[model samples]
Target: MIEVVSLIDAAPPRVFDLELDMDVHAGSLPGSQETATTSTGRRQLALGDEVTFHARHLGLNWQMTSRISAYEPPYHFVDEQVRGPFRALRHEHHFEDLGDGGTRMTDRMSIHAPLGPLGAMVTRLLLAPYLSRLLRQRAIHIKRLAENVDRRR
Candidate 1:
């Protein structure tokens, strides 16, 4: 499990809403080339909503289907993989109100590689760093957008 924490200078509700915005999530990771394969295109995700993403990574096309398994308003949500490249993937987003128009956001990802010991080795040596970078990049993107501009405006 990898935990990435971020502080965004925005109200908890705003941060939480942005976190579930499909467009913001997709746009933040340009390198992944991820796109929603659903008919709704860019839409907000709610509890029990399943989204399939098609992405090109490592010069290979990959697909992952994730469903919003748990949701708590203005607080936290969890998305879990139904089928994907990874053996198992669970992403949890947690938020805390700082009482001064700021939010403390925490993203925790629990991912399991497919090939047992060999896959674990590969994950540790390669996938871990790449995923970590992507996670930090996404956090920064959210922070900037929340602090500087509102994309929904």
Candidate 2:
């Protein structure tokens, strides 16, 4: 399990909308080159939508499909991996309005690796920290974009 929190200098709706933008997401990772291939391959993703992403990570090309199993605009959403490397993966996103044109974003991720004990060990000793860094990077990107947009407005 992993959790990340970010404070954005933008309204909840603005932050929420930016988070759902596929292009924004694709460009968030500097070197991963992640792209949405299929399923809701649009600017914004909605409930019940599925998206397939192809990217290079850890010197390996990987693809994963995930579905937006739950969504509540400007509030909360959840995406669950349908087909991916992990045995199970679910990510929950929450947005809270700060009542002052700001928003608090929280991300919680739960992952279950395959191959039993070996995978568990790998997840604990390696994957967890790697994912934490990745998530922090992503959140920082989002925060920059959101704040920049605010500045331009």
lDDT, candidate 2, equals 0.88
Distance from true location, Cα of 34 in model 1, Å: 1.6
Clash-forming residue pairs, model 2: none
Report per-prediction Cα RMSD to one decimal. 2.4, 1.4
- lDDT by residue (17-40, candidate 1, tens digit) is 888887888899898888875435
Residue pairs with clashing backbones, model 1: none
Mind giving the per-residue lDDT tens digits that candidate 2 earns over 1-153? 899999998888888888888888898886998988647456689998888889998898988899999999989999999999999999999999989889999999999999999999999998888888888898898898888873554
Q: TM-scores across all candidates?
A: 0.91, 0.94
lDDT of 1 at 36: 76
Candidate 2, poorest ten consecutive residues by summed lDDT: 35-44
